[model samples]
Target: MDLSEIKGRIREKSNIVDVMAEYIRLQKVGKRYRAICPFHQDTKPSLYIDPEKEMFHCFGCGAGGDVFNFIMLIERLDFMGAMKLLAERAGITIGDIEHKKGD
Candidate 1:
């Protein structure tokens, strides 16, 4: 499959909360989940996760994005690297990708 197709499959199979819970603790708050931001030093729980939207946002550090972007930042990896890892986590096989610098 092409790269975009592979990414779409990975996203389809991934549960944002389930995937993030593997890295950090999440507390349910009404309709959303709240957690401390792992991207920066935080005094309180600033990251809010909306499972319905499949998105996360940190008020303190201004870090916000979907699941793939979260993986990119937290793992200190580029887009392709995050995609590969996410695919593996979701049990989606990805074909070989030519990863080069400044991607």
Candidate 2:
């Protein structure tokens, strides 16, 4: 899938807290959520998840982005691969969109 389409899908299906929860034990912190960074070793919960922005940033390691970005970083894949993986998780058929886009 293309960048915008992937971004749109991520925006639709992902909640920042829920996505972050997959990798870390998140606790409510003020308006946002906090967790330890999974990408790097940490002890004091340096990961921050902004649900309203649909973004994550690590205060310790500087990794940041939306759900797809998290997937790309953790899975070590490029954008399209992350999109396909997330699309499958959401049960959205990428092939259908691909077919329509070609027309």
Winner by TM-score: 1
- Compared with the true structure, what per-residue lDDT tens digits does model 2 show for residues 1-103? 5556755875598666776677678888889888888889898988888888888899999999988899899889997788787877777777634434533
Query: What are the per-residue Cα lDDT tens digits for candidate 1 across 25-76?
Result: 9999999999999999987899999999999999999998988999999898
Find the 10 residues in a row with the least total lDDT in model 2: 94-103
Question: What's model 2's lDDT at 44?
Answer: 91
Best by lDDT: 1
Local distance difference test values of all predictions, in order: 0.89, 0.79
What candidate 2 gets wrong by more than 4 Å, as runs, is 1-3, 96-103
